[model samples]
Target: MAWDYKVIDGSEEKTDLGFRDEPALNHKRTRILDACKRRDIDDLQALAISRGGFLTDAIRCQAWPILLGVHVDQRGEQDGISDSWTTLKKHRDEGQVKLDVNRSFVYYPNDDTQAQLDEKKSQLSDLITEVLRRQPYLCYFQGYHDICQVFLLVLPPATRAAAVARLSALRIRDFMLPSLNPSVAQLRLIPDILRAADPTLYAHVSRTEPFFALPDTLTMFAHNVRRYSDIARLFDALLAREQAFTLYVFAQIVLRRRDELFLQDEPDMLHFTLSKLPQDLDLDALIVNTAALFERFPPESLRSWRSVSSSSTLKTVRDVSACAAQTLEDGHRFFEKHHRELIWAQRRDKVLRTAWANRALILAVVVGAGAVYFRKAPIWSNLAWSVPDHYF
Candidate 1:
C-alpha cells in the first residue's frame, strides 16, 4: 500500500516513498494509527501537514473522517441520517451529477476494467445525489464529482456519504451555491496572497484575472491535478487547515513558477500557463511553503479581506470549523443565510442595471430630439442662444 513518487528530473526512478526518512515511514504510520486510536485530532492535523501526508490511503481512510470532524467509529450516526436521501427525494442537480459521474475515473486506477470503472461511477453518482438530496440547498457544480470521487476511492461505503455531506456543507459549500460568485470571491484572495508573499510576481501578473485559478481552487485542485495520489496528498493538508488554505496553496504554485511566469510578456500567456498546474509539481514542498505563507500573512491580514463580508460562507465556515461546538447544523444555517443574501443582491444588481440602461436610453432620446428640433427650427435655436447671451 506504499505510494510512489517519480524523480524530479523526468527520470523513472521512484524517489519518494511518501516519507522523508525511509525507516520513519513505519514509525509515522504507527503514530498516525495511535492518533486515530486516541481520536487526537490536533496531533493528527499536525501530522497531516507534516513531511509526508498521512502516508497512504489506508491511513487516510481513518484520518480523513477525523479531519472533516466526522468520527470514523460513529459512521452514519449523524442527526437526520437516513436511507431516504438516496431513494426518496430527488435533488435538482442529480441530472448534472449523472453526466459528470459517467465521465469520472478518467485519470485514476489506471488498470481498472470497464466494468469496475462503471461500478465506481454509479457509486459516485449515488454518493453525490445522497448529499444534494439531503441538503437540498446545495447546488451541484460540474467538477463536484472530481472531489467526490476522491472520497469514494478512499473511504469505505458506510463512511463515504456522511463524509461527503459534511465536506460539501462545510468545506466546499461556497462552490455549490446557485451562482459561482461566492467561489470567485474566494479566488480574489489569491492575488492578495501573491501581493503579500511575492510582490514582484504579483505585479508582473497583475493584469490577469483570478479566473485562471478557478479550476484549481474551485474543485480543490481535484480537477487540475491528474494523479489520485497527488490530489489525496493535497486534500490531507486542505482538510487539516482552514477553508481559505486552498488559495494559499494556489498562490504558492504561482510563486513557484515566478521565473517562467516572468518570461511571459502578455497577460494572456501568463494566465494560460497558470490556468493549469505543472504536471511534475512537488506537492510536499508546495504544501510546506503554503503553510509558511499562510502563517506569514493570515487571511485577516490580506487586503481582500474587506471584500468578503462577515456573513459569507467564506468567513462563517472558517469561523465555525475551528470551534469545538461547531456542527453540520451550523453549516446548513450559514448556507441558507448566504443563499438568501446572494439572491437579494442579484435582484438589486439587476434592478440597478435596468435603471441605468433606461436612463441612458432616455438621455439619448432627449438629445436626439433636441438636435432634430434645432436642425428643423433654426430660429428657435438662435433665440435660445440670444437669450442665454443676454442673461449672462
Candidate 2:
C-alpha cells in the first residue's frame, strides 16, 4: 500500500471502526455526578485518576476544588473554594443561619426628598433569623441566588426571614468564577447536545478542532426551565421521577449523550440535530429554571420568580436590583436634565466671580486716581495761575 512514500514514515494510522455503545458511557457519567452531589471526594478522586488520559470535565468541576485550597492554583484558591466555604461557615456558626443574609443599597424616588439608606438593615436582620429557623442546613449551601428566594417566597414570614438571612450571602459574582462550574458545564454541553442534534456543526469542529465538540445539553438542568407538568410527569415515568429534575440536567444530558457523540466517528445526523437548540437563554429564565428544580411550583402558577443574594437583611433582591437600576437611571436622567444648566451656572459663576474681583480692583484704582487728580490738578492750576508773585 505504501510504495512511493518510503522516506516519509506513516506515524498516523486509522483505528478500527464499529458502531458505538452509548449506554455504557452514560452510566459512567451518571456515577460521577452522583458522587459529586454526595460530596464523595474519594470516589471522585479515584475516577479522576482512572480517566487521567481522557480530557476530564467532571474532575475539574468536582474533585479539582478539593485540591483548590491546598495548592496547585493559588490565585483562584482563596476566593474559589476557601472563601465560599468560609462565608458558609460564618453564616452557620454565628447563627446567621437565622439572620438575614443581606446587602445594602437605597431605592430611587419620584421626587427629590429625604431618602435614607440605613432603614432596611434591622428588618433584614429579623428576616434572616426567621428563615434559618426553618432550613438550617441551607447555610453551607452556596450556588444560585434563587434557592433563598424560593424559600422567601414559599415560607411564612418568619421562615422567609431566616432563609433570607442564610441565603443572603449568595453573590451574583459567585455564579461567574470557579463558582461558575455549573454554567461552564452547561455551556460546554450545549454544543454537545447541539452536535448530537446537528452533526455538520460537530464535524466542522471535530475535523478542525477535536476539542471543540459538544456531546450533550444537560447542564441546563440547573438553568431551571419550567416544564409543563404533563411533560415532566411523563419524563418522570421513564426515569426516577425526580431524576429529570432540571437540577439534575448535567447528569442527564452529558451522561446520556456521551456515547452518541464520543464513540461515533460519524458526526452526521445526530450532531446536526443537536446544533439547532437555542443558545441565548436569558438570565431570568435561568433563575426560573433553577428555582423549579429544587422547589416545585404549582402547575398553574401565575408568576415567574427569582432568588437573589441578600444584603445585610431580608429585602427583595428584585427590589435591590430595581433600586440600583433606578438609581443609575435616575442619576443619568438627572445629569441629562441638569447638564446644560449646570454648565451655564458654572460659566455664570465664573463670570460673576471674575467681574466682582475686577470691579473691586477698578473701583480702588478709580478712587485713588480721582483723589490724586483733583489735588494735583488744583495745585498745578494755582501754580500756573500765579505768574511769579502776581495772581492770574
Candidate 3:
C-alpha cells in the first residue's frame, strides 16, 4: 500500500495541514496565555484542540496541569512530602524502580554534569516513591520513571507530584494497574486504531504481538523518542487532548515507519523496528498525522477492550477521580492479601543493606593494607605481577 508522507518544512511554519506558522502560533500562544490567566477551562481546551498544543515550555508548565485538571491554586504551594514518604516503607517495587532509575540518564541533556545527572535520578526516584506511597494502590511499572521524569523537568517538586498523580489516576491509569492486564488491554487498541486509520499497515502490525507498543505506551514515548524537546513537543499535544489520543499517536508512528516495517515479515524483526524510533523523526508532521487519525476514528467509534473504556467519554477530572477510587479499593484488597510478604520484603532489604555496607568496609580495609604492603615491597618483585609474560 502506498502512503503519502507529509514533508514538513521547519522553516515554513504554516502548511496546508493544520500546523500553525510562527505568526499563527504566536497568536495562539497569546490566546492560550490569556485563557490560562483567567483559568478559563473551556477556552483553554478549545485552543489546545484547534492549535495542536501550547507553543512553549513555560506555557506548557502552566497549561498542562490545567488540561490535566490539576488545581490551579496549588501551583506554587509546597505540599511538603507526603506523610507516606516520611514513613519511607520499602515498596515491593522499589528494586525495579532502582534499576530503571539507574538508566534514566536518557532523559538528561548531554551537557548535564554527573552531579546534575545524579540529582535528577535521585529526584526521579523520590517523586515516583511519593506518588506511589500516597496512593499505595498504583503499581509501579518499569517505564513509569521515564514518564515521571517528564513532569520532574517541567514543574516544581510539589506541583510535579500533583500533576503526575492526576495523570496516573486519570490519563494513563491502566498502565499503573496491579498487573499488566489493564495495560495490555490498552495496548490492543493500537492495532484497532491502525485498522481504522490504515488497514494495510494494521494487518502488517497485527501479524506481530501488539505488545511491541508497550514501551511507548507505558513510558508515554519517553522511552522511544531520543530528544527531550521532541518528547516534550509530543506531550504538549498529548496533554492537550484526551488520554486515549496516545493510541492514535502510536498508530501514526507505525504508519509513518511503514516502509521500514513492511520489509520485516517476521515478528522479531518487526518488534526490533518498532522498539527503536528514528532519531530524526519529524515530530510536527507526526503530531499532525496523529490528530488527523484521531479525527477519522474517534474513541467512541473504536472497539473497546475488556475493562478499558473509551477515552473520549473519560475526559473529565471527576471521571478520573472516580476510576482512581475504584482502583484504590482494589489495591487495598491486594495489600491485605500480601501484607505479610511486603513486610518480609522490607525487613530483608534492611538486612541486605547492612550486609552490603559491611562488605564495602572490609573491601576498603583490605585494599588499603594491600596498597601499603605493595608500596614497601621491592619494585623488582612486583614487576612479575605487573608485566605480561610476553613482555618479560
Candidate 4:
C-alpha cells in the first residue's frame, strides 16, 4: 500500500557527518554536479559506480548509459509525441528549476553533435539542484514521469527543493531494484518452509499416489499459462486475487524469517540466485506449493486446466505435521476479487447523487435566465397555462 524505503535508511558506518566532512561531501556532490553540467552523463555515471552510499544507485541509474554502453541506445519508447514536446513547455513554464538536459533534448535532435549536447546539459543543471535539494523522495518517484516533470506537476516552486532532496535520499530504489525483489527471493523457501510447517501433507504431496508440482513452473515457479489475447490479463486477474490472500500468509512467513532474508543472509548473491537470466523467479509456486504442503483433495487448484476441475478446502496451518483442515468461506470477504466493481459502484453512486443535487440548481439557473429575458419573451409564451386549459 505504501513504500517502505522512505522510512528505512541504508546501513552506514557513521551516524554523524559533522562540519569537517561536510565540505568533502559537498566537493563530491559538486564534482558530479559539475560533470553533469558539462553534459557528461558519462562522467557522472563513473562517479556513481565509484562511490558507495545511499545515492550510489540513483547516480548509476541516471547515468546508466555511460556505465553500460557508449551510444546510449534508445531502448524504451519516448512517452508520446505530443506528450514529449509538451513536457518541455511544462518544464519551462512550471518546473522553473533548470535542468542540464532540456534545451539540448528539445532544440537539438537526439542525434545531435557534441557541442549542442553540452549546451543542453548546462540548461538542465536545475535537475541536480532539484534532486540534491529534495534529498528524500527520489527513489519512490514513479518512472515514466521525469522527476523534473513530476516536481512541476506536484509541488509549487518553493517546495520543489525540499522534495528533490527527499527523493535523492530515499532508499525505495533498493527494494525496487531488478535483483532485490523480496517476494521472488523468498518464493523458493515456500516449499521448504511448508515442509517444515506440515510434514505429513508435504510427504503426501511429495511421495503419494497423486502428486504433481505446478506443471507450468519450470524454473522456480514461473507461470507459462496460455495467453489468450494481447496479454494474459484473465490469468493475472485470478493471480491478483489469490495473491492478495497469499501475501497475508506469506508476510507471516517472511516476518518470522526477517533476520535470515533481509539481514543475516548475503543479499547480493541471494539476489542473483533468485533472479533468472531474462526475468526473476516468481512467488506463486512457493505460495501455491506451500499451500500444497497441506493435504489437498484431488490437487486441481494448482493446475491451470479448467477442463479438469475440482474444489479444494484444505488450509495449512503454522505448525509442523498438522492435519490439513478446512476453513469455511462463510462471511469471508476477499477484497481483491471484487474491488474494481466495488470501486466502480461507489463512483457511479457518487456521480448520480451529485447529478441529482445539481438538477435543482440547473432549474433555478434556467428560471433566472427566463426572468432576465422577461421583456424579450412573447406574452403568449409566459401566459400559455392561462389559455392551455380552455383550449384542452
> What TM-score would every model get versus the actual structure?
0.85, 0.22, 0.70, 0.18
Which whole-number lDDT from 0 to 100 does residue 340 have in model 1? Answer: 86
Which scores higher on lDDT, 2 or 3?
Answer: 3
Candidate number that wins on TM-score, 2 or 4: 2
Could you tell which candidate, 3 or 4, scores higher by TM-score? 3
Across 1-392, the per-residue lDDT of candidate 1 in tens digits comes to: 34454322122323265555555777888999999888777788788788778877778888888777675445546445655664667888778888888888888767677887888888888888888888898889988998999899878787788888888888788887787888888888999999988788889988899999998888889997887778888899988787888899989989989899989999888889989789999888889889899899999998888888565656765642363245778778878888888899899999999988799788899999998988779797677777855577
For 291-385, candidate 4 gives per-residue lDDT tens digits of 34433422223322222111110121121111111111110111122233436556998999998889899889999998878756788467765
lDDT per residue, candidate 2, 252-282, as tens digits? 2333344555654555644453343333333
**By lDDT, who's the top model here?**
1
Candidate 3 — what's its lDDT? 0.68
How does each model score on lDDT?
0.80, 0.32, 0.68, 0.31
| Clash totals in order | 0, 49, 0, 23
C-alpha displacement of 58 in model 2, angstroms? 42
User: Worst ten-residue run, lDDT, model 3?
Assistant: 2-11
Cα lDDT of candidate 4 equals 0.31
Q: Write the per-residue lDDT of candidate 3 for residues 1-392, one digit (tens) a residue.
A: 11112212111122222443556656677899998887676676556545345655577778877766565444465333334464856667888888998999674455677887898889988888877777766688888888888788767654788778767766666566554655666677888888887888888888787887888877888887776566766787777666677777888888888888889999888888887767877776777778788788876676754335323123322232233234333434434444444455569989989878799787899999998888778984686578887885
List where candidate 3 sits over 4 angstroms from the true fold: 1-25, 49-52, 72-75, 78-84, 304-392
Stretches off by above 4 angstroms in model 2 are: 1-191, 199-392
